[model samples]
Target: MITYSSNQPNLYLVGFMGTGKSVVGRRVAEALGMVFLDSDRVIEEKEGRAIRDIFAQDGEAYFRDLECKFAQMGHPKRGCVVSCGGGMVVPDYVRDLLKERGVVVVLHASVDVILERVSEEGHRPLLEGEDRRERIEALLQSRQGAYADAGEVVRTDGLTVNEVVRRVIGIYRLNEPNFPL
Candidate 1:
């Protein structure tokens, strides 16, 4: 069992799609008695449409702008768990913003695992074309360094949801000494 410190900072989860940021973030927030905010979900709610639609109707750049805006202003308080979109931290400025806000944990999974987890989901605009495996590989390769630079990296491959949550909490306890348990 781990106990946190006195200043509970926000927790930001960043990763490729299907790496369980939203799912695991919710659980971590519950464990820490904090609010959970999914950037994509918040954007969707604000736009009154799905993210896929936002991409199609506007464009990836527009959607990414929304993501940046969310990162800038969406957070309501500290001691919250924020699950960022897969591409949110790809931009250096956005990545820096998240890192400045709190402990940014990069959740990672194998390409195979990512494909398997996201296979059933057709809503991913970036993975729309054929050869999704190749796409996933390429995107992961491109963003690998950015994710690595975000903060502590947690590999979620073959790990149960509870196990991943525990790992994140452990990382938080280790890195955020000013944050109380």
Candidate 2:
């Protein structure tokens, strides 16, 4: 695993949709004085199109390939807090790629919480449909195991953002004690 000079491992946050990877990643980065980046945003900027457009036009296979490429590009010059797209970790290759770079933390939420969190979000292309909740539940069932296989797993049920950040930081320190938070 890649190690930072401060003896801290780069934190890559992975989770199902609506688990607040982006929001919590920002908070974690700020708390740890590290940079924050979202892989989906990077892909969107690179493709000059929204993720929905890419998926709608090209297909999920194309998007998944790009996601793998983006993840393989590795972490920042210093340590960074990376917020991966929801489906990014479903593939085993992506999981291995992340493991090589630094610590992987999967943020998990119950299906009900996930559905509620994503219900009003129009930008979530994957969750669009008549039975969005059921779809998300099915996806969660398939991915929860892979997510659990990551270096650390944090459930974001009743916890505050601060609590989540603290838990992540604690996990990072445990994984790479050489790095300072």
Candidate 3:
């Protein structure tokens, strides 16, 4: 029954790293006249360190717990575009929670595109080791189901940021129970 009216509802963007979540999220927030937030950035500000440092010092389990915490109550429940960290929606409860809070859109790109996009970024903790392609493939394969159930899936490959933003808004509008998809 929850649907966006004249006011902007919370919009969540979830997917693997380098899938244009943050970029498209900013544009979407601008188009919708809503606030924009990146979960990773928020967590980093709160923890006072980079995510790689968090993973290195406390390990991934700890970082994941932080992500869960953020999903639970770290950000506003409405009127914002939340660009979630790449595995934030892996947990069913968190994904379900985000869906209930608002629209959860999964922005996806092919493995090659992901590789190309993230190849230069040294902040990826999970993809730091050798054989990054293999790692991305394996991780994507493992989270396929979770991502599928996350909400609306938007493929970002070959699409401009504005294009993706438009598509996300379109999807969100049609997601109301009474509206046609």
Candidate 4:
């Protein structure tokens, strides 16, 4: 088991779009009595613009840089759950940074499920102008390795929100006993 300091075990939920990271994260945080933070929301607040606007004005690379900074900023509260953006774990540095700080869990779902969940979410700039399903499929394929390399992979396709949150709490306890989730 990884021995973390008193402030360790910041649970970071990372995966492709529509993977329920934010929703599950909020629940897990509540269940464990920890704070919940969404990295994208943090970026949106700091940048003074919506994510779509950030992408439109600055491009993905710039947005990614901001994400990396946001991830590294280190939340004030220990044992918090952070819902990271889909592409956040694709960067090795970002993954390593999270690993150093705390546990990172990848929430996985089938491509069809991802497509279905993200269908109505028009704010995703990457899925904006193209064949949305194909784009999401391609993205999932591309990020599969990085997602797999995260702390643990939780397949959430058929699970209810409560089930997923319970799974996360269990995983947290099993994988990170030091933090006492």
TM-score of 3: 0.92
Which ranges of candidate 1 are over 4 A from the true structure?
1-7, 178-181
Provide C-alpha RMSD values for all models, in order: 2.5, 3.6, 3.7, 3.6
Model 4 TM-score?
Answer: 0.91
Q: Which of 2 and 3 is the better model by lDDT?
A: 3
Cα misplacement distance, residue 50 of candidate 3 (Å): 0.5
lDDT of 3 at 13: 93
Backbone clash total, candidate 3: 0
Clashes of 2: 5
The C-alpha stretches of model 3 lying farther than 4 A from their native spots are 1-7, 176-181
CA lDDT for candidate 2: 0.82
What is the lDDT, from 0 to 100, of the residue 13 in candidate 4?
A: 92
lDDT of 2 by residue, 1-181 (tens): 2233433457899998889899999988887877788998899999999999999999999999999888877346347889999888888888887887778889989888888888757677777765887888788888877888765889999999889888988887777544434
lDDT of 3 by residue, 1-181 (tens): 2333334558899999999998999888877777899999999999999999999999999999999999999988777889999999999999989988888899999999999999867678998766999999999999999999998899988998888988998887776342222
lDDT of 1 at 21: 97
C-alpha local distance difference test of each model: 0.88, 0.82, 0.88, 0.83
The Cα error of candidate 1 at residue 162, in Å, is 0.9
